[model samples]
Each structure stands twice: as structure tokens, then as C-alpha cells.
Target chain A: MFSRDRWQEIFQTIGKNKLRTFLSGFTVALGIFIFTVLYGMGNGLKNSFNEFFMGEATNTFSINPGRTSEPYKGFKKGRAIEFRNDDIDDIKKDFALYLDEITPVISFSATARYRGESNSYSINAIAPPYGDMQKTIIMKGRYVNAHDMAGFAKNIVIGRLVEVDLFGHSESAVGKYLDVGGVMYRVVGVFQDDDGDNEERMIYMPYTTRQMLDQGTDKINEIMLTYNTDIGYAGAMAFDLSLQKYLKAKHNIAPDDQNAIYLRNMADIVQRNMMFANILQLVVVFVGIGTLIAGVIGISNIMVFVVKERTKELGIRKALGATPASVIGLVLQESIFITTIAGYVGLVLGMGILSLMGDRFKEDYFISNPGVGLNIVIMATLILVFFGVLAGYVPARKAANVKPIVALRDE
Target chain B: MIVIKDLHKSYRMGTNSLHVLKGLNLSVEEGELVAIMGSSGSGKSTLLNILGMLDEADSGEYILDGVPIRNLNETKAAKYRNKFLGFIFQSFNLINYKTAIENVALPLYYQRVNRNERQEKAMKYLEKVGLKNWAHHLPSELSGGQKQRVAIARAMAAEPKVLLADELTGALDSKTSYEIMDLIQEINDEGKTILVVTHEPDIAQMCKRIIHLKDGVIVEDSFVEQVRASSYVQ
Candidate 1:
């Protein structure tokens, strides 16, 4: 079936009929080209959604203190509520099965001086588990540990940008001392955050040290924790309601008060954004398939016309002792060859365009690094070529079965 | 060599059938140059089509080179046609894109001849037709006589037992017609059985035997004094 002479004959025909070959090839190429570009753009949009919504830990909740709006149990309305380190132990003990990790945050702004380079930065004094909840990536040294908290040690973990700012990119900030608000704190680590430069510009220290600096009080500004993921969405929502009620009762605030304790659940937000991204991808794939179908139709139409055009030549070949099978093989092989080559050309061109446009559309169009996987595009091309064979086969069979007498007769 | 007995053929034109060949009987021996003569609608082409295995006789006994040609499927018929008969059409019927030598090599290619031998045989045939220098030229680039010569070379390349020519000179001027007829006579001198279908009396006189047909039946069959076409060709 794979004869060099047959291939040579097909090449001669194709070379002689340039317009016919180009017409058929252009249809297939254009079809795959549109499909690749659309699929890549869809992936880019999904990437953007992921980068925006998935920057931090998804199965987490953070609660902040607010002024009470209702009076309850002798506590007057308009009373300011506060969370302390003891509340962390209470939640951990009460919800041990549902809680993965918990941390307290004491936020303050301070100007730090390291060798005369000073910058005002937000400082969060936190426990060790805060590193997991925030998904912090440590670049140098280590985070604040239990020993530092128990000893009330003045050790801090600075952000990546903070290190560059204080040390001017010439020195490692780890193990170096920086004077902040008249107190000297040794930097123990440098960390980075995917949530962009804002998270990368802050500093972290032991909460016990911060509490000691504040006259040894146990006051904390906020509480953060990640729940066990095996508890699905419904379980997480139930946990959120229960935690809210417990915090309200502990702070002596009214049950229906909305301002006493503010809570944000990352799981619910992530789920909603994920659903939107999936729907967007579905729409893109639907359009891509439509393009491929149009391409198939286009190739089918061209093949029919080509067979009609070659009726006389086919008659001559048949008269010269060409079997019906040989006639069909010639046409079918030519169709497959053109479709496969043209589809590959379209795939390569689309990928090249995507890489050249890399991240240029991210800020304006929410399409980041637009491209499709090689396996996906190749599979799509093979499907198109398969359909191309069907398209060529119908007309080829018709031409082959035509009686030479009828075919050679003047039209 | 060829034989036919009680050959019958018809065409249905939308319910009404037109009988083309009605119970025809004929025979010819090897090396005989025979001409079939008829006017339009006289079944000359239809008879030639059946003889060439391009069409089937509805009910008849037909044999070529000792092989009975009846109830044969398309593939078997194609093989028989390729191995036992050669055809020269009025319009030349060359594949326009292929060069003369490639066109000549087509039949040998179907016969499974290797490339080098197919080329060598095609070149030999082109030399026989006095067009060896035009072997690489496409049909469109050749003149009418040269194109017909290429078609003749292509038909002869397979070396079949019988050569069938259907109005082989109909599309050419008288001078070129005589030249083609002269070539046909030279081939017949090689002991190959040949049948020429034509309406022209002069073309028929060039053959050793002539069969006249009318209204789908043989009206006359007789041997005539052969006129050599080479005497008239310049």
C-alpha cells in the first residue's frame, strides 16, 4: 500500500494543480489555527483567575475585633471588643477535631534602621503556625519558633523586599540586628509571598515579644486558623457559624450583633471563583470544537470539487489498468497528507504566536501566558485529519466506481 | 486472437431499451489487421467497447487469447484488460500533467514493473514511435501528431495480445492520419492481432479485412486488397 511510485504520482498531480492543493490545505490549517489560539487563551484566563484567588491558603478563616453594636450580659452597646492569646487556646481546645492550625496576629507600624537605611513597614507579631496559614516561603534562615515566644526573644522574620530595603541587596538580613522603635530585634529569616510585593514588604516577629513590649499584656488584634479540609464545604460553613457564636458569647456581645466579630472564610471565596473559571473554560472549548467542525466542512467541500475536476484524468487512469482500489488510494492518501501537514503548520504557528505574546495581555485582558499543551493540540490535529479522510473518501469512492466509458464521454 | 458468439447488448434510456448489439457473431485470428466500419448509432463503438472489456455483453460468449471473458468481476476484468488488450482512443486521452515517458510507463507500473525497467521499456516504446527526444515533454506541450504518438506508445508499452483503436485518426488531419495508420501497419507486421474501428473507407482499406455494421448487426464481412498507408505518408 505504501508504494513510492504512487506517492510520486500524487506529488506530480499536486504540483501541477497548485490552486486546488492550496484551497484544501488552507481550510484545514485555518481550522486548527483558530482552535489552538482560542484554547490557549482560555487556559490563560484560567491561569489569571488562579493567580488572583489562589494566592493564600484556601481552607482558612481570619477573625478581627470590632466595636459591639448591642448590649448583652451587662456589657453596654458601643463597647470595644478585644481578642487575646487565651482565645486561641479556647478555640483550639473546643474545636480540636475541626481545627488544623491557629495563630494570633498583633499588627503595628514601625520604622526600622539598619546601618542608616530606614523604612516604615507594617509588623505582624505571630506564632509559628502563621507561616503555614499564610503560605509563606522562607528564603533564608527560619521563622519565629516556640522557644523565642517562651523566652520573649526579640527575633524577627523579614519579607524579601524588606531585606533588600534594609540591607541594600549587599548583605543577608538573617542574623543581623535592626533597631525598631527604640528596640533592637535580630532578623532570623527572609520570606517571599506570591500575593505580590505588598506581602513581600512586611515583617513578622514573635507575638510574645510584642505582648511584652506592650506592658506584658495578653491583648491581640486578630485570630487566624485553617480548618481540616476533610470537612467539606457544608461542614466548614457550620464551623464558621459555631465559631462566630462562641466568639460573641466569650466577648459578652449580643448574639445578633453583626459588628462585634468580623470573619472572612477563604474556602467560600475560592469555590465561587473556581466555578466561574471552569465555566469560562467550557465556553472556550465549545467554540474551539465549532471551529474544527467548520474546517471539516470546508475540506469536504473542496475535496468534492477536486474529484469532479479530475473526472477525465481518473478515466484515463482506469483505462490504463488502474484498479478501483488504486484510484481510491491515490486520492485518500493525498487528502491525509495535506491535512496532516497543514494542521501541524497551524499548531506550530499558534504556539509561536502565544509565546511571543507571553504575559502581554495579563494586565489588560486577564490572559496570562496564553498557550495550549502540545499533546492537546496534536490530538486535535489528528482528529481533524481523521475527519479529512472521511471527507475525501466519499468523493474518492464515487470517482473510482465511475465507469471509464461514462467518465471519458464528453460532458 | 479473438472469438465472439451470439453477443448481445442494450442500453435503457429511462424505461425504453435501445438494443445496440444484437446476437453478433465474429472471429479473427492472430496477426490479422481488421477494421470495423459503421455510421453513427450503428453499434461500432459499443462492439469495440465489449471487445476491449470496457463494457460487458449482456448475453454472449467472448474469448480473447484463449481466455473466456464472461461473468468477470471488475478487478478480474481490469486485470484481463491490462494483460490481454491495449486501447487507443480518438482524443488521445493522455494525462496532461505527466510527461510523455511517464505516461507510457503508467501501464507497466500497474503491472508491477520496477522503476528502472519501467523507464527503460517506456523509453524503448517512445523510440519506436519516433518521439524519444520528446519523452520528457508533457502532453500539452506536444502537437496533435506527437500526442497521438505518445498515446500509441503508451498503449504498446503493456505488450498486450490485441490492440484496439477507436477512430484513432478522427481528430487528426489527413496527412497525420496517414502517418498514424502507417505506424499501426508497422505494429501489425510484428504479429500482433489488431482491430481498427473507423467510419472512413480509406482507413478501412488500409486493413487486410473489413466488417461493415448497420442497425446493430453485421451487414457485410470480407477480405480486401490491403493499401499500405506508408505509400501516402510524406
Candidate 2:
């Protein structure tokens, strides 16, 4: 609790020792500043990494065929491998209960013609389930359906950028006819993705229509599959091992041939990335707290000096009927005042730098909005109080313990 | 009113203990102006400190204004000190940073009086001490005599029953010293009991009663002819 007299006294004392007070306050401000900047950068790194997994299911994994790296039985190294359409049927018949959605992908770069406005885009032929599984947000119309695949209809879904390039950003191109390398298809949907230009410069069509155009019957590039619920780290690893064994057995490859087939599980990547982020956040907390502790120690040292220098004044106050509690209150209040003021300065400076950085900096892996959140502000406030109390307690006790008679006698 | 019986105090100088007060007894009626005089090491300072409640006696029975003064906690002791006593120190002891009125308002601030009332009472006391025009000036801006007057105003602002002046004029020249003694005399004439601790015979002669001490015991305690401090050249 502070009165006007107490506040005036604190300010007067601080003003009397300007350099000493500034240096002490600088420690706390610097600590909080470093904390805000470092923790914000850490969050930026985490979110940037998270951008890698965006617009796709975290529990999903993809299998890609690869050349053999080892020989087993009559099979030799360097032999190319490829997936077939029958593999999708076999996987579904066997693990239909465990799988949420499974689709084979076959994409190729093609030039699209919309009334003489041509743009080059990668055209991917996928099953209907792929749109929902990959989180493709259709801005207008609809994706390819089972009827489209079964009837071999000339229906297609164009990405937002492809629409802009071909349709001039005027309106939805749904129901419009577009020729893909002389093969005409009707645009049924327009989709956007978080991956920016890369996802935008693509097109989606039915797998059956792409297979018909491939000339290699039933050939597929990769199979993407996801579970109904999140499969954690251990589960993802176990699934990877089992799937690898099943593929090797079915394709007649060597059991120990490491490169026969490759698997990339989104769940495994998510788990590893999450663990890294958690460790980074924990390190920021420790470093921030460490910086604050150093600042608190500085405050404590300055307060001890203040107590020593004010011995005579304290004695005078005591002789005038100030209780020990009031003496302690005076010391503690001064420390708290200094620390809180310093901490606020740091907070404002730190956040100002972050906002400026956010405004000017371009997006990379960290994506958008690279700054501290509400939790960090709350945490910093709590630290201010803790440091204030900790830094002032010992010196205030010393002030309270002074004997008025002896102190007054001090020269 | 004050009473003390069998008060004893000592200081430890390394392994040996030096006894300062050995079974001292004293009594003073309300409104009396007394002077305590002693040579150095006579333990008069210690006795004055005991009387002011700034130090605890090793053994003593003391009473001031009908309340027993024995091992009171710091809080209660502070309350009693604020309610019953005022002090004017030789060095003035005015908080240097505060203005004259603010320095006078310090005790009332401790008493948790509201700001407006504290300032009003402080100004009243400052006017009583004849420093109303200098109320806003800092102690550093005032002369030695003016600073003592501010300290006197601060002491009396709480309206205590008794005033203790410990060498209140020691740091001032003779002219300023006589002026401060004259002010103290006027205050005592208003029926407030007062005690002055000093070594100067002239200062001691200004009081109605004088107590002499040597080697921790009172050698002489008697009434004396009171001299008017205002009659001295200032």
C-alpha cells in the first residue's frame, strides 16, 4: 500500500541515484525483452514446421514404389517397381475396418485451354474420398463423385490459381468446358489450399479417366491412406512396419530389401515435429526464467545498498513512530515499483519489434503471425510480481530489523 | 507525567560489559520543564533514550502518562510514541527531500490521517512555529534555525502531551540556540511537559529544574531559577 508521501520518497531516492537505478532497471527490462523475442521466435519456428503438414490429414501415410536396393532369391538389385490398381482393391478388402479413406494418385503436367486462354497446370486424377481426406476446400460446385469415376465422365476440379489463370478471376468456372491437351473436360469444382502457389497450380479429375489416358492399364503412382482417428507415434511406427511387410510379400520382393518400397506416415512426422516444438518451448521458458532471476538478483543487490544508505533516515522514521511493518512496506513498495515499471517497458518494446517484424517479414516455413500469444503476456506479468517480491523481501527485512537508537547514533 | 524506578542498562564492549545505568529512579510532573546535564560517558544519553522509548532498559519500571512502558511490541510502542510523545533532535532530522509542510506532516501520515486533514494540521503547526510563509520551501533552502523550527513544527503536529528535545540547539550558533530555547519555553508555558538534554550550562539554566548525572547515577537533582531565553541577545 502506498501513500503520496511514499511514492514521492521512492521517486526521490531513485532520482538521487540515477545511474544505479537505471542499471538495475535495465537488467529487468533486458531480461523481459529477450524473453519476449526468443519465445516469439520459437513459436514462429514451430508454426513454420507445422505449415509442412497443413491441408492434409495428420494420421495419413503414403506408399511409393521404389527400385530394389537388395537381391533376394532370383530378384536382383536396381529392378524398378510399380504399383497396380488391384493393390487398392486388395488393401480395401483386407483393412477396410482400419482405413478411413484410401486413394491412388496419378498426376501429369498438362496445358489447359479455356477459349484460347491457356495455362500449364498439373492435372491429378483422384478418387472422391481424396478431397475430404486432403482437406481440399471447394469454393464452388463439387468434387468428382463415384458416378463420375464409374461412368468415366469428363468432370474435373480446378485449383483457385488455375481458375484465375484460365478464367481471369471473374467468376466460378463450374460447368465450364476446358480442354486438357485436346481432351475436353467439364470443370465441376474450384478448390483452394494453404500451400499457396504449389497447390493452386493444380487440377483434380477422376482416376478412371486418367488411367484411360495413361495407356498403361491399371498402373498407379502412389496410394494415400489415412486412419479414422489419430494414431500416435508408437501406433504409426507399428503400422509402417506391418504395411511394409505386407507390400513386400504381395509384390514378391525380398523381405529385407530396404528400398523395395518407401512409406511416409504423416502421423510419425507430426509426432516428431510436436516433440521438437515442445522441447523448444520448454527451453524458452527456462531461458526466460533464468534471465528474470538475474534481473531479480540485481534488484536485490540494489535494494541492499538502499537499505544501508538509508539507515539514518529509517531511524528517524522509526523514532517518529513508524512501525517495523511500515518500514518493510516502504522498502518492498519501492522495489516493486521499479521492477514493474522496467518490466512494462520491456514488454512494450518487445511486442513493438515483433509486430514490426510481422508486418514486414515475408512468409516462409513459419507461415503467418509470428509473435507471442496471450499466454506469454500472462506469464511475463506473473514473472514481474514474482521478481518484485523476491528481490525486495530480504532488504525490507533488514530495514525492519534496524534499531532506532543505534541507527540514529550512526554518523 | 513520567515515573521510573530501578532502571538499569549496560553495553558490552567485547568480553567486558560496561554498566551505564544502575538502579536509576526519577519522577516528573506534567507541564514541568526539566534539563538533564552530564559529562561524556555519564550515561545521560542512554537515560534520555530510555525515557524517549528509543531503547529498552536491561531492567526498569517506567510509566508515561499513566501507561506502563514495558516490553511493548514495536507496533504498540510506535502507537504510544505517536500518541504521547514528540521529539526535536539536534540535527533537525527533517527528511531532506520533503517540503517544510510535508516534513511536518510525516507523523500524521503514519497515523493514517487522510491527506487533506494531514496537510491542514501540518500547516497549522507550521504557522504556530512562525514558518507559515516558508511552508513550501525544502529544508535545504532554509537556515539552521528555520530547519529546527520545521522540526519543532513536525514534532508538535501530532499534538503529543510531552516534547523531548535532545541537544536540539547543539548544531546552531548561540543566537539561533537562544531563539529555539525561547520557542521551547513558550511551548512548555502552554502546559505541555518538556525535557531538554544538553551539556551547556547556559542551556540547562533556561529550564525550571535541572538534574545532574555522573557515572550513570544522578549526583544532583533540584529546582533552579528559570531564565527567560528571549531576554538573551539573538
Candidate 3:
């Protein structure tokens, strides 16, 4: 199997028949190239899906209060529902085993001024855990903590764009005093949001401070909480249903009310989007495999033609004392060599093209960082080579087993 | 040395069978230069094919160099052909892609000889055929006579016990034919057993004995006064 003589003979044949070798090699290379590119693009599409639907925490749920549309327990059908601070404590005490973090949000738009600059920014008053839920990357100082909430401290965390607008780009926004709606607040942190520019233009503060400024009201505009991930998807769904039921009952709303409360479960959206992405990837893989099969058939056709063309040469070799096994070995080894080398060439070229086009198609085509894993590409190449051997074997065996007299008789 | 007894061969042609060799019997002693001659379709080629082990006889006993050649598989037949027999065809079937030396070294390569020794032996055989300077030239670059010389060198490179030439000079001109026959005679002079198959009377006259076949059976078997091909070389 490791005969230098055999390899030398193969190289001589390949070198002498440049066109024949190139034709067969080109078929295999194109197959693998298309396969790699298709697979990488599929992965890119999945990346885009994940970024769009699952950029924030998947375990967190946001519940917003709305007007009640169904009457229950003597409440009118058009009653306006509201979430109070006591509801947060009730949910925490009831779902303590399944809850990870809880936060109440009191959002309002306010004009913030610092020295000479002023801009209207949507300000969200929340707890420390809200930073994790929103996936905020703190650039300077820190988030609103428990001590600030307890003391109702007028400390604020500004978004990146908010800092740029009111404080300008030249100076740090942290530890600076900013005026919001006639109140002076000290900026404790400056942060960035991956959810894009709109999120980066907002500001955050302690909910206790916002409530104190609201004439000591205990009302919250929205409630957000993260559930323990040890509970799987099914458990998360069940928890969502139970939490909705509990909230509706506490508000004295109808069980089947359409508009009493609204719940947005990130887990459910993430799961559905992931399913869609997987199906798309499967389709791409099938197309890739089909291309590979076409390549195998292409190489097979070329090999059959090659063997037929070399009938006379093979007869000469047999007459010179080449065994049937040696004849088969020669053709099989040549096929494997050509396929392996060509497959690698295709893989490298495809990967190079992908890297060169990295993230360029992210906005228009929803294909982010398009590329394939090395292990998968290598496996695909090996499969093609194996088929290449089969393609060569069938024809080589027929030629090898042919009698020299019959072969010589062929013109 | 070769012996064939009661050899029979047939080819199936659609619904009928054509008998090629019908119960033929022949024997050649060591160092014999024999020529088998006949018209086309007289089974001369079929006989040569059987004797060279390229085709097996339907019912026959073939013994070459004290080894029985019956019911041997492809590998054994190939080994025997490599070790005991050398063949030369009219077309001088040298692999076109290979150089003269590479073509000559092919048989040695099949014999599992090391590269250096194979090249040395191939070069020696090329020198024997008076083509040592043309050893590195491709077959396409050589003349018909030179190509036949390379083929002959390749056949002899394996050091077989017998040399079989089937119309060895058919593709050459009258002068080149005689020149090739001269080389054959020189090889036979060195005590090598050789059989030349040809229909040409002049070619037959060059051998020490001639067997004429007609319709798959021998019509005449007789000794001849050998005409040295060297005398006609000019």
C-alpha cells in the first residue's frame, strides 16, 4: 500500500494527462466549495435570528398592565388595571422557588440638562438586577444598588448616547450632576446596550426615588423578572401560565380576560425562533449533500471514460506482468489522491471567501459571520473521497480483471 | 523450454462456437529458435496467446521450465509470465508517456526490483539493443525501429527463460525488419529459447525450425537451413 513505485507511476500518469486530471479534480472541488459555502451561510442566518429574537436574557419575562376588558368580582369591564409595589412582593413570596430576580419599572420621558446641553430621554427607574436583565455593559461607575433604593438617593445611570448628548464625548458622565425635570441627580454609571441605538439613548434610576418624586405613590408601570433556568422550556411555559393566572386573580379580573394584563415570555419566543433556524439549516444541509452526490457521479463518469480510454495502455501493463491487484491499486490510489487534494483546495477557498466577506452581509442579507466548522468540513471531504474511491474502484476492477488478449484486441 | 499437449480452444460467436486451436501438440527443447507460421485466422495468434499465458487453453497441458501451467489463477499466471516468458508485439507497445528507460524498467518494477537496480538493468538491456543513448527519449520521439528496439529491451529486462515475438517486424520496413531479425538472431545465439510467429517466408527461413499451421492444425513441422538475418541487414 505504501509502494513508492506505485506512487511514482501514478504521478507520471497524472502529470502526463493534465487535462484529464484537472477535469475530474475540478468537479470534486466545486462540489465541496458549494457545500461549504451553503453550510456557512445557513449558520449565518441562524446567527442573525439569534441576534434579533434572543439578544436579551431568554429566561426573563416582562409583564405590562393594561385596561380590563372582562368584568369580574363586581369590577366594571372598562376598569384600568395597575401593578403596585405590593404585587412584586406577593410574586416574590409565591414563586420564590422558581424566581431568580425581580424588578419593577417606572418609565417616563424627561428633558435632562448638564451645564449647557439638554436632550429629551426616556428614563427607566429600576433595581440593580434590571441591569443584568437588560444586558447593560457598564462602562463607568456602577448601577443603582439596594442602598440607593433604600435611601431614595437621587443617583442615575445614563446610557451611552445619553452621556454623549448631555455630557458630550470629551468628558466622563459618571460622578457628574445632571438636571432632570427640575431635580438634580448625580450620574453613577454610564453604559452601552447591544439592542441598538434607541436603548443606548435611555437613562436608568432607582424605582424608590422615582416613586418618591411621584407624590409617594406605590404604583409601578411594569414588572420584569428572570426565572431559574434549571426549569426547562416546558417548566417555563407552565410558570408563565401560572403567573398570568395568579396576576389576573389578584387584580379581580376575569380568568379568560383578553386585555387585563399582557405577558411577553422571552423563553417562548427564543424556542420558536430556534426551531425555525434549525429547520432552515437542515434544508441547507440537504442541498449541500445533493451537490456532493452530483460531484460523485461526475467523477464516476470521468473515471469510467478514463478507464475506457486507457484500455490499450492497461493491456500493455498486464502483458508486462502487472497483477490485477496492482492495476486496481494504481487507479484507486490516483482517484483518492486527486479527490483529497481537490477537496482541501475547495475548503480553503470557501473559507477564505467567507472570512473576506465577514459580517458584510449582516445588515442586508441577515448572514452574520458566515463560516463552517473545521470538523464538519473535514468530515464532508472524507465522505467525498470515500465516494471517489468507489467511483474509481468499479471501473478499475473491470479494467483490471479484463484479459490481456481481449484488452490488446481493443483498438 | 515449453511443451503443449492436446491443446484445444474455442470462441463463442453469438449462437455458434469457432474452434481456434484444435487438439494441437507441440514441444520445443532448450535453446531452440522456432517459428510458427500460418495465414490469418489459422490460430497462430491464439496459439501465441496461450503459450504466453495471456489466454488459457480450454483443455491442455502446458509445462514451461519444469513448472506445470494448468488452472493457474491470474496472479500465478502473471508471476509465471514475468519470471519465465517475454513477449514482443508488432506494434512495439511501449507505454507512450514513459521514456525508453522507464518503459524498459516497467517489467523490473513488477518483479519488485529496487529502483537503482531496475534502472541499471534497463539501461543494460537498452545498450544491448543499441539504444543506450536514446534511453531517456519518449516513444513519440523515437522512430518505429527505435520503438521496437525499446520494446525488445523491455521484454528482455525481466530476464525471462523464453522470448516470444508475434510479428515482431510487421510494422517495420523491409530493411528495419531485417535489422530487427538480426537482433533476434543475436539473442538466440546466446542460448536463449525464442519463438517467432510470422506469415512471411523470409522471416520463417531465418529460424532454425518452422511449424506451419492451417485451420487450427499443424500441416508441416520440419527443420530448416537457417538464413542469418545479419547477412540481409544491409
Q: Which stretches of candidate 3 lie over 4 Å from their true place?
A: none
Residues A200-253, model 2: lDDT tens digits:
778999999888876847988999998667555676677778888988988878
Task: For residues B1-234, write the lDDT of model 3, one tens digit per residue.
Answer: 799999999999999999999999999999999999999999999999999999899998989988989887888888888899898999888899999999999999999999999999999999999999999999999999999999999999999999999999899998999999899999999999999999899999999999999999999999999999999876
lDDT at B27 for candidate 1?
A: 99
Give the docking tier of candidate 3: medium
- TM-score for each predicted model, relative to the true structure: 0.94, 0.92, 0.98
Error of 3 at B168 (Å): 1.2
Evaluate fnat for each of the predicted models and list the values in order. 0.47, 0.51, 0.65
lDDT of each: 0.91, 0.84, 0.92
Summarize candidate 3's per-residue lDDT along A1-411 as a digit string, tens digits: 788888899999999999989988998898899889988988888888888864488999999999888778998898999999999999999999889999999999999999999989999999899999988999899988999999999999999999988877899999889999889999999999889999999889999999999999999999999999999899899999999999999999899997989999999988888899999999988988898889888888988888888888888888889899988888888888988999999999889888888999998999999989999999989988888888788888899888887887787
* Tens-digit lDDT track of model 1 for B21-82: 99899999999999999999999999999998889999989989889999876677778888
Ranking by lDDT: 3, 1, 2
Q: What is the per-residue lDDT of model 2 for residues B170-233, given as tens digits with 9 covering 90 to 100? A: 9999999999899999999999899999999999999999999999998999999999999994
